[model samples]
Every structure is written in C-alpha cells, then in structure tokens.
Target: MTSQSSLATEDTPPGGPENPGGGSGLQAGLKNRHLSMIAIGGVIGAGLFVGSGSGIAAAGPAILISYALVGAMVVLVMRMLGEMAAARPTSGSFSAYADQALGRWAGFSIGWLYWFFWVVVLAVEATAGAKILNGWIPGVPQWGWALIVMIVLTAVNLAAVGSYGEFEFWFAGIKVVAIGAFVIVGLLAVFGVLPGSDNPGNGFGHLTDSGGFFPEGPGAILTGVLMVVFSFMGSEIVTLAAGESEDPQKAVTRATNSVIWRIGIFYLGSIFVVLTLLPWNDASILKDGSYVAALNSIGIPHAGQVMDVIVLTAVLSCLNSGLYTASRMAFSLGQRGDAPKAFAKTTSRGVPRTAILGSVVFGFLAVWFNYQWPDTVFDFLLNSSGAVALFVWLVICFTQLKMRGIILREQPEKLVVKMWLFPYLTWATIAMISFVLVYMLTDDAGREQVLLSLLVAVLVVGVSFVRERVQRVR
Candidate 1:
C-alpha cells in the first residue's frame, strides 16, 4: 500500500459492475491557479478574523507566541501530509494513506471522524453565514437564511469540483484581500502616517506597555492556544483539494512549499499589526474584534460594519469548503469499501452527487438540531468534533512516520515533498499535540472539547473494528 503502488494507475478507468459506486471517478477540473489560491486562502478563516479578539484578550500580546507555536506545528503536520498526498493524491488524503500505512481501522476511523467534523462545520458555518445575511435582510428568518446558504453552496459543490474550486477561489480571495489591506493600513497607522491623525502611533509598546505580554500570566498562552488552534482547522483543505487538480503532485508540492510564508505573513504578520496598532488589552478589541479594532484605531469609518462583510465572506468560504471536504472524504471512503457503495456515485459532471447530498442532509439536520436545542444537541456536536483537527494531525504524523519508511524503501522517487527532520520532527509534532491535549484537560472550557472528541474518536474506532471483524467473518 505504498503510494507508488496505490497511485500507479492515475488514469485507470473506473470500476466495473462488481464495484457499484466506483463507476466514473472524480474529475480533475481544478486548475493551477485554483490550487495556489486554495493554498493561500485556506489559512485565512473566520476564526482568525473573529476569534483572535478573545485570544488577544486572554494572552495579551503574547498570543502571538501561541499562534506561532501552533502555526509551526501545523506547518510540520502539513508537510508530512503533503508528503503522503504528493505520493498518492487520493481524495481521502491522509485517511487513505493511513489505510495503507497503518491499518483499515485507522483509515476508517479517521476518514469517518474527519467527515463528521466537516459536516458539523457545514451546519456551524451555514448558521454563522446566515446570521450575517439575516442581519442585512431582516425579512429572512435565521433558519431560512441558513437553509438558503446550505442550498446554494450544496449546488456549487454538486455541480463539479471546478465549481467548488472557483467559488472557493473568490471566497478566499476576498478574505486574503481584506486581511492584506488590514495589515497594510494598520502598519501605516502604526508609524503615524495616516492623514489627519497626529497620534504618534502606539508602536511596539503595546506588547509590554500595558501589563506586559503575559499580563494574564504564562498559563494563558496555552489557553490562547486552545482558542486559536481551531482557526487553523481548514489549512489542510489544500491537500484535500489537490486531489482534484490537473497535476496533484505539483499542487501538493507547491502548497507544501508555500505554507511557511503563508502562515508567517497571514497569521503572525496580521496579528503583529493588530497588537502594534492597539494594546492587546484595549477594550475595543474584545468588543469590536481585533481586525475591526485595528481599523477603528486608524479612524476608518464603519470599520465594524466593513469587518462584518468580510466575516460573512469567510463564513461562506468555510461552509463551501466544509461541504466539499466532507463529501470527498465520504466518496473516498465509499470507494475503499468503508462506507456505503452509494456514497461513491458521481454525476455525469464527476460530482459525487450522493456523497454531497448525504453530507448536506446531515448538515441540514444538524442545523435543525441547533435551532431546536442550541444548548443541548448543538453543543454536544460542537464539542464532540472540536478536537478532531488535533486527532487528525496525530494520525497524519504517525502515518507519515510509517509511510516515510515505506516510500524511502519502495519508491524513493515520490519524496518530492519530504517532511523535515523525517522521523524526528514527526515525533516532536506528536509530542506537541499530545501535550496540548493534556494541557487542554486542565481547563474547564477546553476540558469538555478534548473529552468529547476522545469519546467520538473511541466510538468511531470501535465501529471500524466491528466492521473489520464482520467483513472477516463473511
């Protein structure tokens, strides 16, 4: 199950009657630009825009360190994932690699868990996006707006991979542009360059001037990590999306190569501007959000309103990509015989119609549960999937460690995007994630997320084991 053997026939024809849903496979409609943008835009999410306010408030300016730590961890994980993805380029991404490198149990558990995570994200993002729309158009009820957002994005994904890519391209473009402008303008204002403002820019004093970077105490940095790490959840979309690109290996390579600079510029760079423009303790940051507060500090009119529009775009982008990621994972699982055969079915346009519809149906139901019991069912769904990103990364690191050996021995040629320090950094990443998980248990807010996620993980693994045993008996 080395990548070389798994992807030996990239152009092979579809499965025959014996494999019901594996008829015509997914189309490679994603272009070079699509991959590049997905790589760039996937890192910029609504979390960075909205959630950072709370991070800044918690860890003060030192939240930058929290982001840097998590960012580095993610970069390593993606490198490892990119290595496997470049070698195989399956729509299942790490899950497929896990199947080959680990066992069917690992693949089945992770694929289904990842699918569950994103489908839940579909409901969350849909509702978040709907709130913005409902704000603009008061006539539409919140649920109606949620339904509209889900239906529209579902249509885009069901059309074709290219449609998803193109829509994500623009959605991500808006986020990139908005953040880029925010960083630029905030920098200019930091140096007292903005017109009509005599304020001798706050400079770097904000990092220490208030109560110092660790005003909230050193422990808060880990708390900040808990708050911000989830923002990095969708960064793996590049690896997932690359499977549909015209040249997947090239896409994976380029995406992997650019992750460092992307995280540096987008996450650290933007947060740097925000902290410099205003103190981390600035009440406005907590009230108006870090980005909007930065905008307001420079006297930008309607900064909050402007940020709402950008946040809406980010929400829509997340929903669109979430649906795409979940459906593709389901499709891949079906192809691997880990899911229902119907999930692997594709339309004439090469869209996984059944997979997309099935994921959306669950998303719609989740949205209903959210409206009906925001405190009960929705909260459980949210907490249960909250830590799956960390779990997925853990699986990727272990898979790559094993897969790396196989790739090196069997097919050294597929090592275009190798993980740095090989087994060393891979092991370090696992340790770091484990430390984070352990650290999460010490806090009330993070404790439930980790516990619930572990519960879900255990349940999925149990099901995989049962499935394997049942198949063996037959």
Candidate 2:
C-alpha cells in the first residue's frame, strides 16, 4: 500500500495521499497549539452548552451518567484513531485509514457521508450564528446575516488553513474560559455563597432531589445519550488535524493521551457544575439554558447576554470547522480516485482550493435551503445528517480492528498508542456503538433522525458500488 500503486507519481511521497500541487490552494501553517485547540474546541460546540440543557431536561441530573457513557465511547474511538494516525499521517485522515485497512469502498462511503454531515452542520451553524448577529444588529435581516457569515468563513478557509485554525483557537478559547467561569460561579451559587441563589434544597441536593436520580427512569437517560453523543462528535477533529500538523505522530499522541482529561474537564466538569446548580427539570433550565441559569444564580450582571455571546462564538466555531472538514474529506476522496481527479489538485500554498470551493458551494446551497424551504428542507437536512456520527465511529472501530492486525503482523514497530487490552477494548467499543444505534431505533423522538441518516448512508454505499462496476467495464 505504501510503495506500490498504479496512480503513484514521481512527486508522491512514500506514504502520502496524492500531491498534484501548484494548482489548488496554500499550505496549512497551523502550529501544534492552534491545531490542538481546534481539536479540543471543535468538541465543545453549542451542543455542550445549550443543547445539553435539553438533554438534562430529559434525564434530570442522571444525565451525568449519560454524558459519561457517551464520553467513554468517544474516548475509545479516538484512541483507535490515534493508533492509526500516529502510524500514518495524511490530510485524508480516517478515510485514508479506512482505505488502507478496509478498502477503497469503505473510504468512499464514509468520506462522502461525513462530508454531507458537515455541510448540513455548516448551514445549521450559520443560521444559529446569524440569529445571534441579528440580535446584536437588529438592522440586518436574519437571512442576510446568514449569507454574510457563510461568505466570511469561506474566504477565511480559502485564505489559508492556519487562518481557520487561528480563528477556531480564539473562538474555542473564549468558550472554554466562559464555561470555566460558569463552573466556578455555579459552584459558589450552589453552596449558597451568592447573595440570592438560596433555593429550598440547595447544593448537592439538586442532583438527587428531583425524583432521586433517573427522575424519568433509565429510558430518559438513554434518550439523553442520543443527544449527548453529538457533543462528543467534534473530538475526532484531532485525528483530522494531525494530518496537517507539523508533527503528525505527536499530534495523535496528544489527542489520544488528552482524551481522558477532556472528558473530565469539558464534559464531566461542566456537567457536574450544572446538575449541582439546578435540577434538570426546573423550568429555567429549559428556558434560559444551564450556563445562563448558572451565571444568573451567581449574580453575574447580564448573564443572559453573556451566555448569548458564548453560544454565538460556538456557532461560528462550528461553522468554520464544518467547512474546513468537509473540504478536506472531499479532497481526500478525490486523491484516492473515489471522487473526481480535479479535486486532487493543490494550490501553490498547498491548499485544496477546488475541494474547498465545492464544499462551500454545497454549504451555501444548504443555507439557501434554510430560507427557501425553512419548514421542510431544513428539517430534512437535520434528520438526514444527525446519525452520521455513529456511522463514522463504527467505521473507525472496524478500521482499527483491521489496521491493528496489519500493524502487528506487518509493521509491529508502529504501535505507540495501542488500544488497551488489544481486541478486548475494540470489541467492547463496537458493542457500545451497536447498542446506541439499536437504542436509537427504539427511541421515538430520535428514531426518524437515525433512519433518515441511514438512508443517506445506504445511498452513498450504493453509489460507490455502482461507480466501481462502471470502472470495471470501462
């Protein structure tokens, strides 16, 4: 796979994706820190902040267990990805791993589905960001703001990958700092340190007071799991970033090694603070959002406005990452011949301009869809892309299992970040993903979203098969 291929050219490196450069875009100047924060920050989207409020409302404080369950699953998946990425670094990322370990078809299927998911996410975040912008500048229409935001991020990506990374770093940094402050203030309020946060059963009582853990029973926790998994979706960006970082191997190590702490700080820490501050069923928890409620309880002036700023930053960060990721996935597919060869070209600065443009065009269309058919088309987009996180994670597991054997047999030297307990942990994580999918099927609220996403997955698989059959006859 490394040294032999019909498509191989003189300029191609030993283990690199095809590099038909001086045609498309510039090189990514993102350093380790920029890349690292982008990786970490991507995981801390609005889902962790505002969306979790709904998840909490569903499961009460028991949602902590829900987050932990999803977090553990994510950690395992990242470790598997880290092992493969550490061994081989390419901008193609996990799709490359799938191609090498599974087959070209697996890579093509996952790449396109992941790309579709991001494009929809881009539109979703754009709408979300525009709402925030419109609130601040009422003179502008929401639709107009959405258009401007999309164009701005698209230009930033075309400018350079580092620009995207730098922007993401600051956006993510502000979110992290804001959440950290929320935790501190919430803790003070929970303990009745604040002047006005004195509720009937304050402090730790909130965790168990509302129906004594699992208020809505275990089923609600399962429902919360469906919502919580999306929060963990962004962590995989680290493996993607590793491909562009100065030290791909080190990037993987840092990404995987830090997974535990990320879960601890970002997921578990913030969540612990939330449950402590307010019961999951409180009306304010649903209406004002957990972070806002926490801030308000702490007597922070203009807490709602402060939280609005954080949420808006999160939306922009998600928007930037969505465009960057979709383009890279398409570029990887093109380089592998799963997509049009034109997408394989790179700019003088080493960027994939064609792929970037294609992704942005698709995103721009989705943005239009939000306005033109805000009622139905936007709903379909959301449903169709919602379940892709499971698909990507499952592919990662299968790819890891395949790659693990190949590495141990052919290149035992490349096992720095091995999955603990070898095949055991791998099997367990696969089971967890399967369970999530099955539970999703039974979940009335989340069922349609998963099924629609599966339909999109099936179409991608069918198309890849047809494409291969056509090539054979040609």
Candidate 3:
C-alpha cells in the first residue's frame, strides 16, 4: 500500500498553489445550511416517490424488509466512505482514496465510470423533468422542455457552487416537507383520526389482509432489492460536495452520522405509510403510483398533481447534483494525471469550467440519444451504467479496509468517522454488495444490466492499464 506521505507527494491539496488556474481551485462556497439540506435531500430521490410502487407490487408489504435491508447496506457503505472522506477531505472522495490504497488503475477506472454514470443520469433526469413540464404546457414539445430544463440547470451549475446549493436546498426542502406531510396524514388516516380521510381506520391489516406480508413469496424481497438499490445512488453526493465546504471533515462526519435517520425516515417511514394506507397489491399502486395512491386514499385533493410537482422538484434536484458530481469527478481525475490537464484547471471563481462543460456536453448528447434512439443507443446507455452504484460501494469497502490501517499508522487524529466493527463489518458490507450483484443475475432485467455494466467496466479498466503502461515506458 502507498503510505499517506507518498500519496501526498503524488497529488496537491485541492486549491493548493500547484493548481493550474493561477492557483485557484474549488471554492468553499457551500454553507452549513446547504450541506445539511444536501445530506437530507440526497437520500430522497424521485425514485422513492415514483419507483417504490413496483417494489411494493413485487414484494407486497414485505417490500419494507427489502427496503430495510438495502437501507442498512447503504448506511454501512456511507459510513465507510465517510471514514475515508473525513480523514482526507478531498473532492475526489473515494476515488482519491482508491488511488492510495488500491492502485492508480482502481481510482482511474472507478472515477471515469462514476462520471459516465452521472452524465447518463443527467439525460435521464432531464428527460423526466421535460415530460412533466410538457404535460403542464402542451405547447412546447417534450424534447423542447428537455432542452429548456437542461439549459436552465446548466446555467445554475456554471454560475457558482453556492447557486447550485441554494437551488437544491429549496428543491430538497420541498421534497422533505412533502414526504413528512404524507407520512403524518397517512398515519392519521390509518388510525381513524384524519378529518377528511376517505380510508379512515384502514389499519395495519393492509400488511397481511390480502395475501400475507410476502404475497409473492420470501424470495421476492431479493427482487425488490434489485428494484430499489439504484435509488440510493445519490446518498453519497454530500461527501463529494463536502470538499467545497468550509469544513469538509465536519461536513462528511455529520452527513455520515445522519445517514441512518435519513434513510430510515425518508425510505422506510414513507414506504410504511404507503403500505399501511393501502394494500401492496392495490391496482391503484400500479396505476397512479404508491405515493399518489396513498394520498388519494386519504382524500387529498389533486393528489396526483401534488405528487407530480414533488417529483419534478426531485428530478431537477437530481439533475443539478448529477452535473456537479460528474464535473468534480472529472476534475479529480485531471488532478491525479488520470485525465487531461485542462480538466484540472479552474476559473477565477474556482470552478472547473472545462470539466463542467465536458460532462454537460456528454449529457446533452445523451439527451439527444434518448430522443433519437430511445430503444437502441439510450437503452444500452441505461443498462451499461445500471450496476455502477454497486461497483462504487464495493470499491469504498475495500478502500476503507486498507485506508484504516494507513491512517492509523500515519495520521490517527483524522479518524473522526470510523467504520463500526473495523474490518469485520467492512467485510460484511462487501459480501452483501457482492451478493446483490450475484443475485441480480438471476432476474432477466437485472442480468442484462449486470452483464452490460461489467462489459463497460472491463473496457475502462483495460484503458487504464494501457495508459499506465505507456506512462511507465515514457
């Protein structure tokens, strides 16, 4: 393993005098409120609002178990990432740690793959947001709305990191409030107390009245896991954003510690309310979605429209963070000599302009592909990057395992966020991630995603090895 001192020799601190843009680097533009909201909002995605229906449909009320399982895994992974990130406080985050603990190739491959994943997400979220805008104003075509949303958010990101954080703060705040309100109302309706509830006294029978908790069978929980795992992708975005905060270490520590409640309340608490408010196998769930169906059960006026607004906020927030994350990853790669030097350059405001434009350029192309070739090229893009969340978590696990000893031997004071149970829980988290990847192969849709993602990963790793060999020869 590369010692801490050796890793320091290889890379300058972000914003250090060695930076190419006359020594300017990423600014500490994000404030405490921005970081706090980001941590809360990162855990709640449009997927929770929109995608949980299918998981509920698949696993019945037992989808709770699937969610709890995945939630535990995410908490563990974030803890490990927080441990490394708190110690080092780099925008590169896990990718930087991987360079020191694993190898340069490990860092290079994962960093680019992560960047690719978010750029592709930019296309997905932009299109989703467009569909909503076009629904409200039919005059503009769906593609036009897509273009408009992309341009607006791209401007937000390019303006300053503070602008991005401020926008996300409100977007995320809306989502947090929405979910909180839904849970409170749903609970009231369940216990026969809500004043306007249509489904008063629904009770917990919804958990087992229809066909028991595991209506599909116990194994469906695993299937539900496959469905919900991707939703957790953005939970670690705060760690990356922390590098630009005034106190990266404190930001990382707070985000990590709070992850448990974030996942518990946003995911488990909301899903429980939905399942309790209505049956898991309710046709309305499959029809209008879980949250909408739950709201309608409580006699909320225009529940579907309310959810549409919330989902739109979520899509825009995701798009904003996706661009920010992809650019930072590219910038980190540039700093480590794994990407073009221009990517490492920051503007007078300490923004990586080249990196931001490069990520958004691919994002724009991806949006075009979604419109032009929805089935062929765009479908491939989606499937090819589907498993990257697992890949990233897995890398964090291994990196933390190695980094723990190195940090202790070198700078033990930085160990503010330690992984529970040391190597044992770290190893267990690794096993769980591996098991999920292996389990994905059993389902047809998941099999295709895993295989395609593996193929892309192999190609990236091969390129990294070749690049390393050429550097050595020179």
In model 2, the Cα lDDT at residue 195 comes to: 58
| TM agreement with the true structure for every prediction | 0.96, 0.94, 0.97
User: Per-residue CA lDDT of candidate 1, range 1-474, in tens?
Assistant: 233323332323222112354446777888999889999999888888989999998899889999999999999999998988887677788888888888888888999999999999988888888888889998999999999999999999988889999999999899898888888877888888878643359778778999987999998888989889999998888887777788888999999989999999899999999999887888999887888888877888888789899999999999988999999899878878788889878776678899999999999999999999999999999999999999999999999989888788877887788888878999999999999999999989789999999999999999988987897799
lDDT against the true structure, per candidate, is 0.86, 0.80, 0.89
Which candidate number would show the highest TM-score if scored against the true structure? 3
Candidate 1 off by > 4 Å: 1-19, 197-199
The global Cα lDDT (0 to 1) of model 1 is 0.86
Query: Could you tell me how far off, in angstroms, the CA of residue 170 lies in candidate 1 after the best superposition?
Result: 0.6
Clashes of each: 0, 8, 0
By lDDT rank, best first, the candidates go 3, 1, 2
What are the clashing pairs of model 2? 24-346, 24-347, 25-347, 25-351, 26-349, 26-350, 26-351, 27-349
Compose the digit string of candidate 2's lDDT tens values, residues 1-474. Answer: 321221232123323443654353324367889878876776788878878888888888888899999988988998898888787666667787787777767888898999999999898889988988999998999989999999998999888778888898899899888877766767777777755654432879888877988888888888889888887777887766666667777877887888888787888889888788776777887889887876655567888898889999999988888888888888777777878877777766667788989998989899999989987998898898998999999999998999888778876886788888878999999999999998999887579988999998999999988887897799
